[model samples]
Target: MINNVRRDLNDLPQSLRNYLGVALGGAGLVFWVIAVRESHFLNMNAYGLVSILGWPFFVGLALVAAAFTVELFRAPLRSMQLTILIVLLVLFVFGTPCAVEPVASLTSSWVHAGFIQYIVQHGHALNGYDARFSWPGGFSMGAVLVAFAGQANAIGFLRWFPLFIELSYLAPLLVIARSSGVSRRAGWLGVALFYSTNWIYQDYFSPQALNYLFFLVIIAAVFACWQPKPLASYGPQSGFWRPRLHQNRNLLTRSRWEGLDTTSTWTSAATLWVLGLIGIIMLASSMSHQLTPYVLILALGACLLTRRLGRPEMVLMITVLAFGWLSLGASDYWVGHLNVIFGSAFQVSSTIGSNVTGRLLGGLSHVLIVETRILLTGGLFLLAGVGFLRRSADSRALEVLAGVPFLVLIAQSYGGEGLQRVVLFGLPFTGLLAASAIFPLRTGAIKAILPAFSFGRFARFAKPTVRMAAFVVVLGFALATTVVRGGNDSYESFSKGEFDAVNFAYNHVRPGQTIESVNGYLPVGFRGIGSVSVTTPAQRSSTSVRRVGLRLLRDRPSEIILSQSQQLFGEEVSGYPVGWEASLESTLVNHGYIITAQWRTATVLALTG
Candidate 1:
């Protein structure tokens, strides 16, 4: 009877259906299927430490959910600005505690926001630290955003900032996806699942999530430009002089089983305007001698292979590729390497490995699966791609969708060659891979065409018993994972105890009082503090660390960790293979730094006078 009711409600208007989805999603958040068995009273101290990060993350994300909900009620792009205002309100009221992280990473946007940070914090932009470039004559958006974040921190704008930034990605994605005939539900679900995937951790969770949020809008300009000259859709006169704003609606209009009636002059013109704007951005990226052009280049290539490339694509592709070929590597090195082999005409890059550039390839071994693993993971993607191909859906869309993962492979292999390498390579790949799975999860056009139908039949809403059972299953799963990972509450971030040490170090130390951790905790712990240490990976010999510490700290560190349970009890540090356990033990004993409090694996030390 309940299933019958849910089927009946499925045909409700999207606004009503979406509201229902939000309520159900909220319920899922509250009563997920995996957690259960422990009383709520089990971890009392943890409730107190909620301020450390978790609740803020959930709240901030909840605000994001609210913002998406607002977007859902409004159809198309007619009322974007007003919807954004509503989104802003939700964040300010509900999400406030996420501001604690910026103090550590110097998470300002001004530097990353512009040329000043490029020149000062990192000097290589002038002479191409990542590549061999000159000054960044072009605009510096990252530097600007960093500066804004710094300002936001001062004025206590942390809560709304995350929501603002996340929506940057959300808005454009909605505009594009909805216009393209994809269901609003699928589009929102696509962005949510893709953005929240494990692979997006570096972006969505980090300060850089801002960049990921805004970048596609920037890239979309290129796509807009590449679209074909606008033809008319409605009538004879309607086909002329149209702005590209409405152009995408051509490709994105929701269709029944019948195919679209093509070629409208006004509609085409508007679509091309959008495409043209994208093209201009692409050209500008090429001209800037910055990361955008390279990204545009690789993106364009993949775009072409997937059929996303349109008429303007040919000219854009050729021009960028030619300019890129000219600017690659220093003239002298390329000439010398090439002259040595093919009389100077065959200019090749000076790299350590033949196919994989040595510097770039260095990181590949870390992520690169050997033949067996490659065949497995890559094969899965390839098979997924094949399945996508077999679908009779829009060939171009499928092609573009499949090509995103392929592009990641290219970047992962050869083109992770610039400062924007992470943005250039990582962002699109994660989004593409995540979005690709949507097709696989709800297979077949018939089912994909249907909306989610929980509000069916006599039991339009779930019975309390059903809800409780679902809740227990989800609660149990979450509890099980938490237990397996050694009760590490945060599956995504460092624990409260780990974060606590930084505040402990910061407040405890006097201004200008020097400190050191024999282990290189400098980056995470001493964000705003003035300090120095010579901790390098290669020279971290037991003797070298103590000597370096003693020399740098000018005698002995007033405070040091002779033993601090290897960064997270048993979890692995960024690059190191061993968890906290394999952290250096002998090196601490050799140093005069005396152990004080020994809690679990942590041992705080203070130097003896």
Candidate 2:
């Protein structure tokens, strides 16, 4: 049967096969468009985007994965066809939310827009306003973009920012994949897997997103510029019979260090220029984000230890820049909030509890999403480990690069998001290793670190079976990614009505007045920075309508905006009863609050005298 399948595949002309790949890619995109058009935001339920996404989405994803797998096995890979398929897959995975939703998701993205607006209007960052402002490099850059684009504010950039930045990541990703001691097939597969499994929502319109690009570019440059020298072989008489300590000493000798040193074919001037560019990027990263610089430091140290990085001083430079900014430039953030900065240092147990166990507090559907994420991450790492064992390479740089990010957890937890950030930092390398599991190289630039594992006995069965297996695996991950990636869209994504309601509230509410919501899930922060205060039930102990009404009556906010997204968060995540917002609205009306404005998806209540 397998032979028949192989013969059938081989019978097709090369041009026909190329045309077929393109046709499948186009069909997948068409199906995705149909899926997006059919999806209704109101239909989304506790299962999040999967509840609203139709069958066409899955069909589209499967076809794209199949096309990619077919291209992977072609005799001479058509780079153009592979590129088209990969981009289409990226669109299906990362661009779906951008297209289906009426407004950009994430209140934080909206808040970031507001920060950019502040910089554009005030000619500088607002001091003593936000901890994020202390790291104002990205915002400053956004301000420039806003002015250059002739846009009044950064709001216009919010809706499609996630997709744009994710697409931008592909350039550096290509470099890293091709240079990181992997076969061409594994490199391409790793890139696809990276996009397929990237459920982390950090790619929104934020500093971290830009800083992440810097992270990738820096790593890519390092890998591209250098290759490790072959290690020298030791004779049995020299150290085979010596004490373990003596053997260890021999391993640490200056000659050994020279052997581990990396060499590059680039001219001296070019090397110097690349080093300078890396330093500038590191400096910018240090100023733009609190955590990425440190992550970069760890990644560079890993490379140095594994002999992939030739310059040890690069680590010192980034560390100094990161700390220098923290102490001198971002003093406002860490001075009074020292505990917020270093309180969780070395508290691995508590950090894990907060990052993992505490996050499992939502409803069953949410629990399923979180559990799926955990399992997917664990499964990817396990595959990477298997790849490490199966593949033969000169250095273990990929393994070290993927593993060292965990060390960040010991230093600081980054407000329980430490693990997620760790995963993000390690994801590219992990994807490479995972791809090696499926399509490993038998030899590289130097002696193999491990004996190459052979599947020669099953070679006949392997091609057909492995192709099908690869297709299934990629298809499964794409499907699962579509589910968990948008699993929070129930509350995270907003509608046109919600956006309009928040705009209405912002325009009417005066300075010193307060705006309140059932929760912090609404799109409310794109305007009204320090002048108008906003509050949510996130800190409240009870979410009961009566309890919430009592608290609101006492506070007497000038205006309150309630939206569908916030309501869904109350019901789905906080486990409040369905229609809880309606009951809360009634309770507010019974008091001094009057319905001043209303939309299909949102409402505004004014505190009437």
Candidate 3:
């Protein structure tokens, strides 16, 4: 009978096999939505040539192959786990295979965010600074972080699937969910559902999504109100700080960590400090420009509230503050210019505050408060509390509560990194809340079986190696997708101006031309390679970086130049008075600069006379 069954299995068609592989992978993707995570296997390199270009497809294939063989290359997946693995492979091939380049994407986003619009157009990065005017995407640390894993990660595999961010966020949640009565079978299913549904957005916005992932793991530390991590699994505490939420008890005694203490070699502390510094700097450079007030408030709050933030955390905070301020000093936009924004903020502070408050109240009423973003964020954790209360928990749900602080910040600064980024930090919990939704919504027929509270024991089912491999594969996919997509669309639109301008400038610059300009370059200042550059702006023009055409107006510079955003200063020139017409002719003759080309998306009019 066994031989007959084996023969029957062998008779399946090749198409069927391929279909099964992808089918299972898609199921795995859905499973991620149910639990806001990924837990399965795929023969990542199953496809040969395709593996070189689209590794996410290959990784999914590899998982499927491993499942059939029953050998633990990473870890053997259970039958259900194998089903989910195959499905993701299908999705990657048919759905997410196309990609774009990097510089173009970063440049486009910078422009959309209203940053360095005119300057980045004509600027190129040389070492740390832009010699031309502005380096939109240079090789500096800021550039590196942006190009390689800031929001639009360009760094190889990590950005391919946002792995670093996902692994960090999901692992702790998975561990926590299992402890809170998620059966080994059910808990694993939840993870699969979570990944497929919510977190896919990370492929586009890294900082908002990644930071939230980090925030979720920290929140899980709160569930440990009593001993047992989540009510009775036992063991030493994990993470640097045994960070209890505002009023929680010290469930894990220090003595419990003796084994961890041994592994806590001196090198670990120094390593952590160094890593913290780098991470903070990267965060500051990539996203922390306006220096949100919340950061200052959070730092103080964190210092006072959490015991986990020992001397080391203090050191990290100080490091972040000092370095962040220094970056401000270095940039052209912020140096002595912050008063413009704050002054405006202070003026309408009351009105903006009122508008934001109304939105928050409206969101609370609908339960769809996070439709656009945080509410829309992929990974989230549902407190096992609802289940514990009902005697049988259902799916995980979003904590509308966290949105309060975020809503409050809209009055000060509007979009992106300001308050939205910080509010987004709470979004990873969506998965946890999702799990609660999965098990038992008393209203749904599905709930009859999936009890609300299982009180399941905490189990470390996935070993470190398994986790590490899974993380690598997920991140690899997210990073790759981001690089390709951000490029094809964004770059061209953002730099259409600068690219044209550079070509014209090269053709126009003469060996001994004296150029006068009403406005200076971005990232500020330029040296004369062949044309003497007079950097200044508006009416108050000086020869140095301060004034574009001032010194030239007094003396006879062979030519004059004019740019938008600053005043037309060279009204008085050799042939005539430096009004708009003389300013134009003078700049054309003197700087050898003329408007050669123009674009709708960018202000870049290629100039060469």
Predicted model with the maximum lDDT: 2
lDDT of 2 by residue, 402-511 (tens): 99999999988888899999999999999999898888887853333356555787867877877887787788878888899999999999999988888888888999
lDDT of 1 by residue, 1-609 (tens): 646644675567766864553454444334221111111212322111132333433343443444344343345523443344323322222122122222122212212232344433553344422222321323243334446566422223322344455555656655444433243443443344333321211222223343343346644433333322223344333322333233334554332111222222236667667656655544444434433344445555454433345443444654654355445523322443443222422223322132233322112322231222223333334533543433223324434533443343333223323212332243333333333433323432212223333546645354433433322322232222222212111112222343355435545556555445444432233233123222223233233333444453454555554223234212222333333222344444455555554444234555555
Query: Which parts of model 2 are misplaced by more than 4 Å?
Result: 236-260, 444-458, 540-546
- TM-score-wise, the better of 1 and 3 is 1
Give the C-alpha miss distance for residue 51 in model 2, angstroms. Answer: 1.6
Q: Tell me the TM-score of each prediction against the true structure.
A: 0.50, 0.95, 0.40
Which regions of candidate 3 deviate over 4 angstroms? Answer: 1-23, 26-103, 106-139, 142-419, 439-609
TM-score of model 3 vs. true structure: 0.40
**Candidate 2 TM-score over all chains jointly:** 0.95
Q: Rate the local accuracy (lDDT) of all candidates.
A: 0.36, 0.85, 0.34
Backbone N/Cα/C clashes per model: 65, 0, 109
Better of 2 and 3 by TM-score: 2
